[model samples]
Target: MSLLFSEEEFQSAWTELDEPQLDGGWELFTESMGVKIYRLYDQDTGLYEYKVFGVLDSCPPELCADVYMDLDYRKQWDGYVKELHQDQFEGRPAVYWQVKYPFPLSNRDYVYVRERRDLDLDGRRIWVILAHSSPETPCAERSGVLRVRQYRQSVAMETDGARGAKVFMRYFDNPGGMIPAWLVNWAAKSGVPNFLTDMQKACSNYAAYCQRK
Candidate 1:
Protein backbone atom coordinates (compact mmCIF):
# COMPACT_ATOMS: atom_id res chain seq x y z
CA MET A 1 0.00 0.00 0.00
CA SER A 2 1.03 3.59 -0.53
CA LEU A 3 2.25 5.68 2.37
CA LEU A 4 -0.61 6.29 4.75
CA PHE A 5 -0.62 10.10 4.47
CA SER A 6 0.58 13.02 2.40
CA GLU A 7 2.22 16.42 2.80
CA GLU A 8 -1.08 18.13 3.54
CA GLU A 9 -1.58 15.91 6.57
CA PHE A 10 1.81 16.89 7.97
CA GLN A 11 1.14 20.57 7.29
CA SER A 12 -2.16 20.31 9.14
CA ALA A 13 -0.41 18.67 12.08
CA TRP A 14 2.15 21.45 12.29
CA THR A 15 -0.61 24.07 12.22
CA GLU A 16 -2.49 22.33 15.02
CA LEU A 17 0.58 22.18 17.26
CA ASP A 18 1.60 25.74 16.46
CA GLU A 19 -1.19 27.13 18.56
CA PRO A 20 -2.77 24.61 20.91
CA GLN A 21 -5.70 25.85 22.97
CA LEU A 22 -6.95 24.43 26.22
CA ASP A 23 -10.59 24.94 25.26
CA GLY A 24 -10.70 22.41 22.45
CA GLY A 25 -11.21 19.30 24.59
CA TRP A 26 -7.44 19.26 25.14
CA GLU A 27 -6.81 19.05 28.84
CA LEU A 28 -3.41 19.51 30.38
CA PHE A 29 -1.95 16.09 31.12
CA THR A 30 1.37 17.07 32.68
CA GLU A 31 3.85 19.92 32.94
CA SER A 32 7.46 19.63 33.92
CA MET A 33 10.89 21.00 33.02
CA GLY A 34 9.51 23.46 30.48
CA VAL A 35 7.37 20.89 28.68
CA LYS A 36 3.61 20.54 28.80
CA ILE A 37 1.70 17.45 27.67
CA TYR A 38 -1.99 17.50 26.76
CA ARG A 39 -4.52 14.84 25.97
CA LEU A 40 -7.83 14.63 24.11
CA TYR A 41 -9.99 11.61 24.66
CA ASP A 42 -11.72 9.94 21.75
CA GLN A 43 -15.12 8.65 22.67
CA ASP A 44 -15.28 6.29 19.73
CA THR A 45 -12.13 4.31 20.60
CA GLY A 46 -11.92 4.98 24.30
CA LEU A 47 -8.35 6.08 23.76
CA TYR A 48 -6.42 9.29 24.21
CA GLU A 49 -4.50 11.38 21.72
CA TYR A 50 -1.58 13.24 23.31
CA LYS A 51 0.03 16.55 22.39
CA VAL A 52 3.23 17.98 23.80
CA PHE A 53 4.73 21.45 23.57
CA GLY A 54 7.93 22.60 25.17
CA VAL A 55 11.35 24.10 24.87
CA LEU A 56 14.28 21.78 24.44
CA ASP A 57 16.78 23.87 26.36
CA SER A 58 20.24 24.25 24.90
CA CYS A 59 19.39 21.94 22.04
CA PRO A 60 19.49 23.39 18.55
CA PRO A 61 16.59 22.66 16.21
CA GLU A 62 18.82 21.20 13.55
CA LEU A 63 20.43 18.75 15.93
CA CYS A 64 17.09 17.75 17.37
CA ALA A 65 15.60 17.18 13.95
CA ASP A 66 18.58 15.21 12.78
CA VAL A 67 18.56 13.08 15.90
CA TYR A 68 14.91 12.23 15.35
CA MET A 69 15.55 11.05 11.81
CA ASP A 70 18.72 9.13 12.54
CA LEU A 71 17.31 5.63 12.79
CA ASP A 72 20.67 3.86 12.93
CA TYR A 73 21.70 6.02 15.87
CA ARG A 74 18.35 5.66 17.62
CA LYS A 75 19.02 2.14 18.84
CA GLN A 76 22.15 3.30 20.61
CA TRP A 77 20.15 5.66 22.81
CA ASP A 78 16.54 4.53 22.96
CA GLY A 79 16.15 1.52 25.20
CA TYR A 80 12.49 0.97 24.45
CA VAL A 81 13.39 0.07 20.89
CA LYS A 82 13.80 -3.67 20.66
CA GLU A 83 13.99 -3.84 16.88
CA LEU A 84 14.11 -1.11 14.22
CA HIS A 85 14.96 -1.28 10.57
CA GLN A 86 13.90 0.12 7.23
CA ASP A 87 12.47 -1.96 4.40
CA GLN A 88 11.19 -1.49 0.87
CA PHE A 89 7.85 -3.00 -0.02
CA GLU A 90 6.64 -2.51 -3.58
CA GLY A 91 9.37 0.06 -4.12
CA ARG A 92 8.33 2.28 -1.17
CA PRO A 93 10.32 2.66 2.00
CA ALA A 94 8.73 1.47 5.22
CA VAL A 95 9.96 1.19 8.80
CA TYR A 96 9.44 -1.81 11.01
CA TRP A 97 9.73 -1.37 14.77
CA GLN A 98 9.33 -3.60 17.76
CA VAL A 99 8.86 -1.79 21.07
CA LYS A 100 9.34 -3.23 24.51
CA TYR A 101 6.55 -3.18 27.04
CA PRO A 102 6.40 -3.73 30.77
CA PHE A 103 6.36 -7.24 32.13
CA PRO A 104 3.15 -9.26 31.93
CA LEU A 105 2.22 -7.33 28.78
CA SER A 106 3.25 -8.47 25.31
CA ASN A 107 5.53 -6.38 23.17
CA ARG A 108 4.10 -4.25 20.34
CA ASP A 109 5.29 -3.72 16.79
CA TYR A 110 4.47 -1.29 13.99
CA VAL A 111 4.89 -0.95 10.26
CA TYR A 112 4.76 2.63 9.08
CA VAL A 113 6.01 5.17 6.60
CA ARG A 114 7.73 8.36 7.73
CA GLU A 115 8.78 11.63 6.16
CA ARG A 116 10.74 14.70 7.18
CA ARG A 117 10.08 18.24 6.01
CA ASP A 118 11.72 21.60 6.45
CA LEU A 119 9.51 24.65 6.07
CA ASP A 120 9.82 28.39 6.31
CA LEU A 121 6.54 29.92 7.44
CA ASP A 122 6.19 33.55 8.45
CA GLY A 123 10.00 33.86 8.23
CA ARG A 124 10.47 31.11 10.80
CA ARG A 125 12.15 27.83 9.97
CA ILE A 126 10.28 24.74 11.11
CA TRP A 127 11.21 21.09 10.95
CA VAL A 128 8.53 18.44 10.85
CA ILE A 129 8.44 14.64 10.93
CA LEU A 130 5.33 12.60 10.25
CA ALA A 131 4.57 8.87 10.47
CA HIS A 132 1.52 6.68 10.14
CA SER A 133 0.80 2.99 9.75
CA SER A 134 -0.09 1.62 6.33
CA PRO A 135 -3.47 0.00 5.79
CA GLU A 136 -2.36 -3.21 4.07
CA THR A 137 1.15 -4.02 5.22
CA PRO A 138 3.33 -6.91 4.08
CA CYS A 139 4.75 -7.37 7.57
CA ALA A 140 3.14 -10.19 9.47
CA GLU A 141 2.47 -10.11 13.20
CA ARG A 142 4.95 -11.92 15.46
CA SER A 143 3.91 -14.84 17.59
CA GLY A 144 4.45 -13.16 20.96
CA VAL A 145 3.83 -9.57 19.98
CA LEU A 146 0.85 -7.42 19.13
CA ARG A 147 0.72 -5.17 16.11
CA VAL A 148 -0.24 -1.55 16.54
CA ARG A 149 -2.41 -1.24 13.46
CA GLN A 150 -3.59 2.26 14.23
CA TYR A 151 -0.61 4.46 14.96
CA ARG A 152 0.36 8.01 14.11
CA GLN A 153 2.84 10.61 15.29
CA SER A 154 3.93 14.06 14.17
CA VAL A 155 6.52 16.47 15.54
CA ALA A 156 7.43 20.08 14.79
CA MET A 157 10.46 22.01 15.92
CA GLU A 158 11.70 25.56 15.48
CA THR A 159 14.65 27.55 16.74
CA ASP A 160 14.20 29.28 20.08
CA GLY A 161 17.30 31.40 19.95
CA ALA A 162 20.93 30.28 19.40
CA ARG A 163 20.89 27.12 21.47
CA GLY A 164 17.35 26.01 22.05
CA ALA A 165 14.26 24.87 20.21
CA LYS A 166 10.49 25.09 20.56
CA VAL A 167 9.20 21.58 20.09
CA PHE A 168 5.74 20.14 19.68
CA MET A 169 4.59 16.57 19.19
CA ARG A 170 1.38 14.61 18.66
CA TYR A 171 1.23 10.89 19.41
CA PHE A 172 -1.37 8.14 19.40
CA ASP A 173 -1.47 4.38 18.98
CA ASN A 174 -3.82 1.55 19.84
CA PRO A 175 -1.81 -1.07 21.72
CA GLY A 176 -4.41 -3.62 20.49
CA GLY A 177 -5.39 -5.65 23.52
CA MET A 178 -7.11 -5.52 26.87
CA ILE A 179 -5.08 -2.86 28.59
CA PRO A 180 -6.26 -1.05 31.68
CA ALA A 181 -7.02 2.67 31.57
CA TRP A 182 -5.09 3.33 34.76
CA LEU A 183 -1.99 1.70 33.31
CA VAL A 184 -2.18 3.85 30.23
CA ASN A 185 -2.66 6.99 32.26
CA TRP A 186 0.27 6.17 34.49
CA ALA A 187 2.49 5.48 31.53
CA ALA A 188 1.79 8.89 30.03
CA LYS A 189 2.30 10.78 33.25
CA SER A 190 5.72 9.21 33.76
CA GLY A 191 6.92 7.99 30.39
CA VAL A 192 6.84 11.29 28.54
CA PRO A 193 9.03 13.07 31.01
CA ASN A 194 11.51 10.22 31.17
CA PHE A 195 11.72 10.04 27.41
CA LEU A 196 12.45 13.74 27.12
CA THR A 197 15.13 13.52 29.77
CA ASP A 198 16.84 10.67 27.99
CA MET A 199 16.60 12.48 24.66
CA GLN A 200 18.36 15.51 26.07
CA LYS A 201 21.22 13.38 27.27
CA ALA A 202 21.34 11.66 23.91
CA CYS A 203 21.52 14.98 22.10
CA SER A 204 24.43 16.10 24.21
CA ASN A 205 26.34 12.96 23.30
CA TYR A 206 25.39 12.91 19.63
CA ALA A 207 28.43 14.80 18.36
CA ALA A 208 30.90 12.42 19.95
CA TYR A 209 28.84 9.49 18.69
CA CYS A 210 29.12 10.81 15.17
CA GLN A 211 32.86 11.32 15.55
CA ARG A 212 33.31 7.71 16.59
CA LYS A 213 31.32 6.48 13.63
Candidate 2:
Protein backbone atom coordinates (compact mmCIF):
# COMPACT_ATOMS: atom_id res chain seq x y z
CA MET A 1 0.00 0.00 0.00
CA SER A 2 3.06 2.28 0.14
CA LEU A 3 3.51 4.49 -2.89
CA LEU A 4 7.24 4.68 -2.25
CA PHE A 5 8.12 1.00 -1.73
CA SER A 6 7.08 -2.26 -3.35
CA GLU A 7 5.54 -5.25 -1.58
CA GLU A 8 8.97 -6.87 -1.58
CA GLU A 9 10.39 -3.88 0.24
CA PHE A 10 7.60 -3.99 2.78
CA GLN A 11 8.17 -7.64 3.50
CA SER A 12 11.92 -7.18 3.52
CA ALA A 13 11.62 -4.69 6.38
CA TRP A 14 10.99 -7.55 8.75
CA THR A 15 14.32 -9.02 7.80
CA GLU A 16 16.02 -6.27 9.82
CA LEU A 17 15.68 -8.54 12.81
CA ASP A 18 18.16 -10.92 11.26
CA GLU A 19 20.17 -8.61 9.01
CA PRO A 20 20.31 -4.99 10.14
CA GLN A 21 22.78 -4.08 7.44
CA LEU A 22 21.17 -3.61 4.06
CA ASP A 23 24.35 -1.98 2.86
CA GLY A 24 27.59 -3.72 3.94
CA GLY A 25 29.49 -1.00 5.81
CA TRP A 26 27.87 -0.27 9.18
CA GLU A 27 30.27 0.25 12.10
CA LEU A 28 29.54 0.51 15.81
CA PHE A 29 29.01 4.13 16.70
CA THR A 30 27.85 4.37 20.31
CA GLU A 31 25.59 2.93 22.96
CA SER A 32 23.44 4.90 25.38
CA MET A 33 20.22 4.39 27.31
CA GLY A 34 20.37 0.69 26.47
CA VAL A 35 20.43 1.56 22.76
CA LYS A 36 23.19 0.66 20.35
CA ILE A 37 23.86 3.01 17.47
CA TYR A 38 25.75 2.20 14.27
CA ARG A 39 27.00 4.52 11.60
CA LEU A 40 27.72 3.97 7.91
CA TYR A 41 29.67 6.60 6.05
CA ASP A 42 28.59 7.49 2.54
CA GLN A 43 31.58 8.48 0.42
CA ASP A 44 29.24 9.92 -2.18
CA THR A 45 27.61 12.48 0.15
CA GLY A 46 30.04 12.75 3.04
CA LEU A 47 27.16 12.04 5.40
CA TYR A 48 26.60 9.23 7.81
CA GLU A 49 23.60 6.93 7.78
CA TYR A 50 22.65 5.73 11.23
CA LYS A 51 21.11 2.49 12.43
CA VAL A 52 19.91 2.09 16.02
CA PHE A 53 18.74 -0.92 18.00
CA GLY A 54 17.17 -0.77 21.42
CA VAL A 55 14.36 -1.89 23.65
CA LEU A 56 11.62 0.27 25.08
CA ASP A 57 11.15 -1.63 28.28
CA SER A 58 7.89 -0.05 29.39
CA CYS A 59 6.04 1.12 26.31
CA PRO A 60 4.04 -1.35 24.30
CA PRO A 61 4.97 -1.89 20.67
CA GLU A 62 1.65 -0.63 19.33
CA LEU A 63 1.78 2.42 21.58
CA CYS A 64 5.28 3.23 20.42
CA ALA A 65 4.22 2.98 16.78
CA ASP A 66 1.16 5.10 17.34
CA VAL A 67 3.10 7.74 19.21
CA TYR A 68 5.58 7.87 16.35
CA MET A 69 2.91 8.32 13.68
CA ASP A 70 0.71 10.71 15.60
CA LEU A 71 1.56 14.05 14.06
CA ASP A 72 -0.81 16.05 16.20
CA TYR A 73 0.52 14.58 19.43
CA ARG A 74 4.05 15.06 18.15
CA LYS A 75 3.66 18.83 18.12
CA GLN A 76 2.63 18.73 21.74
CA TRP A 77 5.70 16.78 22.86
CA ASP A 78 8.52 17.36 20.40
CA GLY A 79 9.97 20.80 21.07
CA TYR A 80 12.01 20.96 17.89
CA VAL A 81 8.92 20.73 15.71
CA LYS A 82 8.07 24.21 14.52
CA GLU A 83 5.49 23.28 11.92
CA LEU A 84 4.11 19.99 10.59
CA HIS A 85 1.22 18.82 8.49
CA GLN A 86 0.09 15.98 6.26
CA ASP A 87 -0.71 16.34 2.59
CA GLN A 88 -1.45 14.34 -0.50
CA PHE A 89 1.12 14.57 -3.28
CA GLU A 90 0.73 12.74 -6.53
CA GLY A 91 -2.03 10.70 -4.89
CA ARG A 92 0.25 9.66 -2.08
CA PRO A 93 0.35 10.74 1.57
CA ALA A 94 3.15 13.18 2.24
CA VAL A 95 4.29 15.16 5.27
CA TYR A 96 5.93 18.54 5.55
CA TRP A 97 7.93 19.28 8.66
CA GLN A 98 9.77 22.41 9.68
CA VAL A 99 12.24 21.97 12.48
CA LYS A 100 13.69 24.67 14.68
CA TYR A 101 17.43 24.72 15.07
CA PRO A 102 19.57 26.28 17.75
CA PHE A 103 20.28 29.99 17.67
CA PRO A 104 22.63 31.31 14.95
CA LEU A 105 21.46 28.42 12.74
CA SER A 106 18.67 28.59 10.20
CA ASN A 107 15.69 26.30 10.52
CA ARG A 108 15.42 23.26 8.25
CA ASP A 109 12.38 21.65 6.67
CA TYR A 110 11.47 18.39 4.95
CA VAL A 111 8.81 17.16 2.56
CA TYR A 112 8.52 13.39 2.57
CA VAL A 113 6.05 10.55 2.07
CA ARG A 114 5.54 7.89 4.71
CA GLU A 115 3.70 4.62 5.16
CA ARG A 116 2.99 2.31 8.07
CA ARG A 117 2.26 -1.41 8.12
CA ASP A 118 1.24 -3.85 10.82
CA LEU A 119 2.12 -7.43 10.10
CA ASP A 120 1.38 -10.68 11.83
CA LEU A 121 4.29 -12.96 11.11
CA ASP A 122 3.20 -16.44 12.24
CA GLY A 123 1.28 -14.86 15.12
CA ARG A 124 4.09 -12.48 16.00
CA ARG A 125 3.24 -8.81 15.54
CA ILE A 126 5.49 -6.29 13.86
CA TRP A 127 5.07 -2.59 13.10
CA VAL A 128 7.05 -1.01 10.30
CA ILE A 129 7.13 2.59 9.13
CA LEU A 130 9.01 3.85 6.11
CA ALA A 131 9.59 7.39 4.91
CA HIS A 132 11.43 8.85 1.96
CA SER A 133 11.85 12.28 0.47
CA SER A 134 9.62 12.74 -2.53
CA PRO A 135 11.45 12.62 -5.82
CA GLU A 136 9.81 15.84 -7.02
CA THR A 137 9.31 18.97 -5.00
CA PRO A 138 5.75 18.74 -3.73
CA CYS A 139 5.32 22.09 -2.04
CA ALA A 140 6.43 25.66 -2.43
CA GLU A 141 9.78 26.59 -0.93
CA ARG A 142 9.71 28.57 2.25
CA SER A 143 11.35 31.98 2.39
CA GLY A 144 13.94 31.50 5.12
CA VAL A 145 13.91 27.78 5.77
CA LEU A 146 16.34 25.38 4.14
CA ARG A 147 14.71 22.34 2.56
CA VAL A 148 16.41 19.01 2.94
CA ARG A 149 16.48 17.19 -0.38
CA GLN A 150 17.80 13.79 0.65
CA TYR A 151 16.21 11.84 3.47
CA ARG A 152 15.34 8.24 4.22
CA GLN A 153 14.00 6.59 7.36
CA SER A 154 12.62 3.25 8.47
CA VAL A 155 11.61 1.77 11.81
CA ALA A 156 10.71 -1.78 12.74
CA MET A 157 9.18 -2.63 16.12
CA GLU A 158 8.68 -6.22 17.18
CA THR A 159 6.77 -7.13 20.31
CA ASP A 160 8.61 -9.24 22.87
CA GLY A 161 5.75 -11.07 24.55
CA ALA A 162 5.01 -9.51 27.97
CA ARG A 163 8.28 -7.63 28.21
CA GLY A 164 7.86 -4.76 25.75
CA ALA A 165 9.28 -4.28 22.25
CA LYS A 166 12.55 -4.44 20.38
CA VAL A 167 13.13 -1.50 18.05
CA PHE A 168 15.30 -0.99 14.99
CA MET A 169 15.59 2.35 13.27
CA ARG A 170 17.66 3.53 10.31
CA TYR A 171 17.73 7.02 8.88
CA PHE A 172 19.80 9.75 7.21
CA ASP A 173 19.06 13.26 6.09
CA ASN A 174 21.38 16.00 4.90
CA PRO A 175 20.47 19.09 6.87
CA GLY A 176 21.12 21.59 4.07
CA GLY A 177 23.86 24.20 4.55
CA MET A 178 27.22 24.08 6.20
CA ILE A 179 26.92 22.30 9.51
CA PRO A 180 29.83 21.62 11.78
CA ALA A 181 30.97 18.00 11.98
CA TRP A 182 31.19 18.25 15.77
CA LEU A 183 27.63 19.51 16.01
CA VAL A 184 26.35 16.68 13.84
CA ASN A 185 28.34 14.13 15.76
CA TRP A 186 27.11 15.47 19.10
CA ALA A 187 23.55 15.33 17.95
CA ALA A 188 23.93 11.73 16.88
CA LYS A 189 25.49 10.78 20.19
CA SER A 190 22.97 12.56 22.40
CA GLY A 191 19.94 13.42 20.31
CA VAL A 192 18.72 9.86 19.66
CA PRO A 193 18.71 8.73 23.28
CA ASN A 194 17.06 11.99 24.29
CA PHE A 195 14.36 11.52 21.67
CA LEU A 196 13.74 7.96 22.80
CA THR A 197 13.45 9.11 26.37
CA ASP A 198 10.93 11.74 25.44
CA MET A 199 9.04 9.27 23.27
CA GLN A 200 8.70 6.86 26.15
CA LYS A 201 7.22 9.59 28.30
CA ALA A 202 4.89 10.55 25.50
CA CYS A 203 3.79 6.93 25.14
CA SER A 204 2.91 6.82 28.81
CA ASN A 205 0.81 9.99 28.48
CA TYR A 206 -0.89 9.03 25.19
CA ALA A 207 -3.95 7.39 26.64
CA ALA A 208 -4.66 10.47 28.72
CA TYR A 209 -4.07 12.72 25.71
CA CYS A 210 -6.57 10.76 23.63
CA GLN A 211 -9.10 10.93 26.43
CA ARG A 212 -8.75 14.71 26.53
CA LYS A 213 -9.17 14.85 22.77
Candidate 3:
Protein backbone atom coordinates (compact mmCIF):
# COMPACT_ATOMS: atom_id res chain seq x y z
CA MET A 1 0.00 0.00 0.00
CA SER A 2 1.05 3.58 -0.63
CA LEU A 3 1.74 6.12 2.11
CA LEU A 4 -1.04 8.48 3.13
CA PHE A 5 1.40 11.30 3.83
CA SER A 6 3.41 12.99 1.11
CA GLU A 7 7.21 13.07 0.84
CA GLU A 8 7.38 16.53 2.35
CA GLU A 9 5.22 15.50 5.27
CA PHE A 10 7.43 12.47 5.97
CA GLN A 11 10.59 14.58 5.81
CA SER A 12 9.19 17.20 8.15
CA ALA A 13 8.08 14.56 10.61
CA TRP A 14 11.43 12.79 10.44
CA THR A 15 13.35 16.03 10.94
CA GLU A 16 11.38 16.78 14.10
CA LEU A 17 12.47 13.42 15.58
CA ASP A 18 15.76 15.02 16.60
CA GLU A 19 13.92 16.47 19.62
CA PRO A 20 12.39 19.75 18.52
CA GLN A 21 13.21 22.87 20.45
CA LEU A 22 10.56 23.90 22.92
CA ASP A 23 9.87 27.61 23.16
CA GLY A 24 9.96 29.57 26.44
CA GLY A 25 6.50 28.36 27.32
CA TRP A 26 7.63 24.75 27.64
CA GLU A 27 8.16 23.25 31.09
CA LEU A 28 9.99 20.25 32.49
CA PHE A 29 6.98 18.37 33.69
CA THR A 30 8.36 15.23 35.40
CA GLU A 31 10.82 12.36 35.23
CA SER A 32 10.03 8.77 36.05
CA MET A 33 10.75 5.20 34.98
CA GLY A 34 13.98 6.55 33.47
CA VAL A 35 12.03 8.69 31.01
CA LYS A 36 12.13 12.48 30.94
CA ILE A 37 8.79 14.05 30.10
CA TYR A 38 8.33 17.62 28.85
CA ARG A 39 5.30 19.79 28.25
CA LEU A 40 4.77 22.88 26.12
CA TYR A 41 1.93 25.07 24.97
CA ASP A 42 0.81 24.56 21.42
CA GLN A 43 -0.34 27.93 20.12
CA ASP A 44 -1.96 26.42 17.06
CA THR A 45 -4.06 23.84 18.89
CA GLY A 46 -4.55 25.57 22.21
CA LEU A 47 -3.47 22.39 23.99
CA TYR A 48 -0.43 21.33 25.96
CA GLU A 49 2.21 19.40 23.98
CA TYR A 50 4.06 16.34 25.31
CA LYS A 51 7.40 14.68 24.58
CA VAL A 52 8.96 11.59 26.19
CA PHE A 53 12.44 10.12 25.92
CA GLY A 54 14.18 7.14 27.51
CA VAL A 55 16.12 3.97 26.88
CA LEU A 56 14.89 0.42 27.31
CA ASP A 57 17.64 -1.77 28.67
CA SER A 58 18.04 -5.25 27.08
CA CYS A 59 15.49 -4.64 24.30
CA PRO A 60 16.72 -4.50 20.73
CA PRO A 61 15.50 -1.71 18.49
CA GLU A 62 13.91 -4.03 15.96
CA LEU A 63 12.20 -6.03 18.67
CA CYS A 64 10.84 -2.85 20.23
CA ALA A 65 9.47 -1.72 16.86
CA ASP A 66 7.89 -5.12 16.29
CA VAL A 67 5.88 -4.90 19.49
CA TYR A 68 4.14 -1.75 18.19
CA MET A 69 3.49 -3.12 14.71
CA ASP A 70 1.93 -6.27 16.05
CA LEU A 71 -1.50 -4.76 16.46
CA ASP A 72 -3.42 -7.95 17.20
CA TYR A 73 -1.38 -8.46 20.38
CA ARG A 74 -1.57 -4.89 21.71
CA LYS A 75 -4.29 -5.75 24.20
CA GLN A 76 -1.89 -8.15 25.86
CA TRP A 77 0.09 -5.18 27.19
CA ASP A 78 -1.50 -1.83 26.38
CA GLY A 79 -4.02 -1.38 29.16
CA TYR A 80 -5.32 1.87 27.72
CA VAL A 81 -6.37 0.36 24.43
CA LYS A 82 -9.77 -1.25 24.40
CA GLU A 83 -10.00 -2.19 20.74
CA LEU A 84 -7.74 -2.10 17.70
CA HIS A 85 -8.17 -3.12 14.08
CA GLN A 86 -6.76 -2.47 10.64
CA ASP A 87 -8.38 -1.37 7.40
CA GLN A 88 -7.49 0.28 4.12
CA PHE A 89 -8.37 3.66 2.69
CA GLU A 90 -7.93 3.99 -1.06
CA GLY A 91 -5.43 1.14 -0.92
CA ARG A 92 -3.48 2.76 1.93
CA PRO A 93 -3.22 1.15 5.39
CA ALA A 94 -5.28 2.58 8.23
CA VAL A 95 -5.77 1.68 11.91
CA TYR A 96 -8.63 2.24 14.31
CA TRP A 97 -7.93 2.46 18.03
CA GLN A 98 -10.39 2.79 20.89
CA VAL A 99 -8.94 3.96 24.18
CA LYS A 100 -10.29 3.40 27.67
CA TYR A 101 -11.07 6.34 29.93
CA PRO A 102 -11.92 6.67 33.58
CA PHE A 103 -15.44 6.88 34.92
CA PRO A 104 -17.56 9.94 34.02
CA LEU A 105 -15.47 10.43 30.91
CA SER A 106 -16.34 9.09 27.49
CA ASN A 107 -13.88 6.78 25.79
CA ARG A 108 -11.83 8.19 22.92
CA ASP A 109 -11.09 6.70 19.49
CA TYR A 110 -8.65 7.42 16.69
CA VAL A 111 -8.34 6.37 13.04
CA TYR A 112 -4.99 6.91 11.42
CA VAL A 113 -2.62 5.61 8.80
CA ARG A 114 0.67 4.40 10.30
CA GLU A 115 3.93 4.34 8.42
CA ARG A 116 7.33 3.02 9.42
CA ARG A 117 10.84 3.44 8.10
CA ASP A 118 14.41 2.60 9.04
CA LEU A 119 17.17 5.10 8.49
CA ASP A 120 20.76 5.73 9.52
CA LEU A 121 21.34 8.94 11.41
CA ASP A 122 24.98 9.79 12.09
CA GLY A 123 25.88 6.10 11.83
CA ARG A 124 23.12 5.10 14.23
CA ARG A 125 20.26 2.95 12.98
CA ILE A 126 16.84 4.30 13.80
CA TRP A 127 13.32 2.95 13.36
CA VAL A 128 10.46 5.40 13.13
CA ILE A 129 6.73 4.73 13.27
CA LEU A 130 4.39 7.64 12.64
CA ALA A 131 0.62 7.92 12.94
CA HIS A 132 -1.80 10.82 12.46
CA SER A 133 -5.59 10.94 12.53
CA SER A 134 -7.42 10.73 9.21
CA PRO A 135 -11.10 11.58 9.47
CA GLU A 136 -11.51 11.15 5.75
CA THR A 137 -11.42 7.39 6.25
CA PRO A 138 -15.03 6.23 6.32
CA CYS A 139 -15.95 4.87 9.77
CA ALA A 140 -19.08 4.62 11.80
CA GLU A 141 -19.20 6.51 15.08
CA ARG A 142 -19.40 4.38 18.18
CA SER A 143 -22.01 5.06 20.82
CA GLY A 144 -20.84 6.52 24.13
CA VAL A 145 -17.48 7.29 22.65
CA LEU A 146 -15.89 10.50 21.47
CA ARG A 147 -13.81 10.45 18.34
CA VAL A 148 -10.47 12.23 18.58
CA ARG A 149 -10.52 14.68 15.69
CA GLN A 150 -6.91 15.81 16.04
CA TYR A 151 -4.13 13.41 16.96
CA ARG A 152 -0.53 12.75 15.99
CA GLN A 153 1.94 10.41 17.62
CA SER A 154 5.29 8.99 16.63
CA VAL A 155 7.93 6.62 18.00
CA ALA A 156 11.64 6.78 17.27
CA MET A 157 13.90 3.92 18.27
CA GLU A 158 17.68 3.91 17.93
CA THR A 159 19.91 0.94 18.57
CA ASP A 160 22.00 1.00 21.76
CA GLY A 161 24.38 -1.77 20.79
CA ALA A 162 23.17 -5.28 21.75
CA ARG A 163 22.04 -4.18 25.18
CA GLY A 164 18.90 -2.24 24.29
CA ALA A 165 17.42 0.69 22.37
CA LYS A 166 16.85 4.38 22.93
CA VAL A 167 13.26 5.46 22.42
CA PHE A 168 11.60 8.83 21.92
CA MET A 169 7.98 9.78 21.48
CA ARG A 170 6.06 12.96 20.64
CA TYR A 171 2.31 12.90 21.04
CA PHE A 172 -0.67 15.27 21.00
CA ASP A 173 -4.36 14.55 21.05
CA ASN A 174 -7.43 16.66 21.73
CA PRO A 175 -9.89 14.54 23.65
CA GLY A 176 -13.18 16.06 22.58
CA GLY A 177 -15.61 17.36 25.21
CA MET A 178 -15.56 19.41 28.38
CA ILE A 179 -12.43 18.03 30.02
CA PRO A 180 -10.40 20.50 32.05
CA ALA A 181 -6.90 21.48 30.88
CA TRP A 182 -5.43 20.82 34.28
CA LEU A 183 -6.72 17.27 34.30
CA VAL A 184 -5.30 16.71 30.87
CA ASN A 185 -1.88 17.96 31.88
CA TRP A 186 -1.98 15.91 35.03
CA ALA A 187 -2.82 12.76 33.13
CA ALA A 188 0.07 13.32 30.78
CA LYS A 189 2.46 13.75 33.66
CA SER A 190 1.32 10.76 35.67
CA GLY A 191 0.31 8.30 32.99
CA VAL A 192 3.24 8.59 30.57
CA PRO A 193 5.92 7.21 32.86
CA ASN A 194 3.85 4.23 33.78
CA PHE A 195 2.97 3.72 30.16
CA LEU A 196 6.65 3.68 29.19
CA THR A 197 7.41 1.23 31.94
CA ASP A 198 4.63 -1.00 30.70
CA MET A 199 6.00 -0.69 27.19
CA GLN A 200 9.45 -1.80 28.26
CA LYS A 201 8.06 -4.89 29.89
CA ALA A 202 5.79 -5.52 26.94
CA CYS A 203 8.72 -5.46 24.58
CA SER A 204 10.59 -8.01 26.59
CA ASN A 205 7.56 -10.24 26.97
CA TYR A 206 6.67 -10.02 23.31
CA ALA A 207 10.17 -10.97 22.25
CA ALA A 208 9.91 -14.09 24.36
CA TYR A 209 6.43 -14.82 23.08
CA CYS A 210 7.60 -14.58 19.49
CA GLN A 211 10.43 -16.96 20.10
CA ARG A 212 8.10 -19.51 21.65
CA LYS A 213 5.70 -19.23 18.74
Report lDDT (CA) for all predictions.
Answer: 0.85, 0.85, 0.79
Which digits, one per residue and each the tens of the lDDT, describe model 3 over residues 31-118?
8757777888877656787877777887888888888888877877888889998987676567999999999899999988888887
Give the lowest summed-lDDT range of ten residues in model 1. 1-10
Candidate ordering by lDDT (highest first): 2, 1, 3
Misplaced by over 4 Å in model 2 are 89-92
Tens-digit per-residue lDDT, 153-211, candidate 1: 99888887768888888888778788976677678788888988888888899999999
Give the winner by lDDT: 2
In the order shown, the candidates' Cα RMSDs to the true structure are: 2.2, 1.7, 2.6
Model 3 scores what on Cα lDDT?
A: 0.79
Q: Which stretches of candidate 3 lie over 4 Å from their true place?
A: 6-20, 43-46, 89-92, 121-123, 211-213
Candidate 1 lDDT for residue 55: 90
Worst 10 residues of 3 by lDDT: 1-10
Model 2: per-residue lDDT, tens digit, 74-117? 99999999999898866657899999998889899999888889
Per-model TM against the reference:
0.92, 0.93, 0.87
Candidate 3: residue 111 Cα off by (Å): 0.9
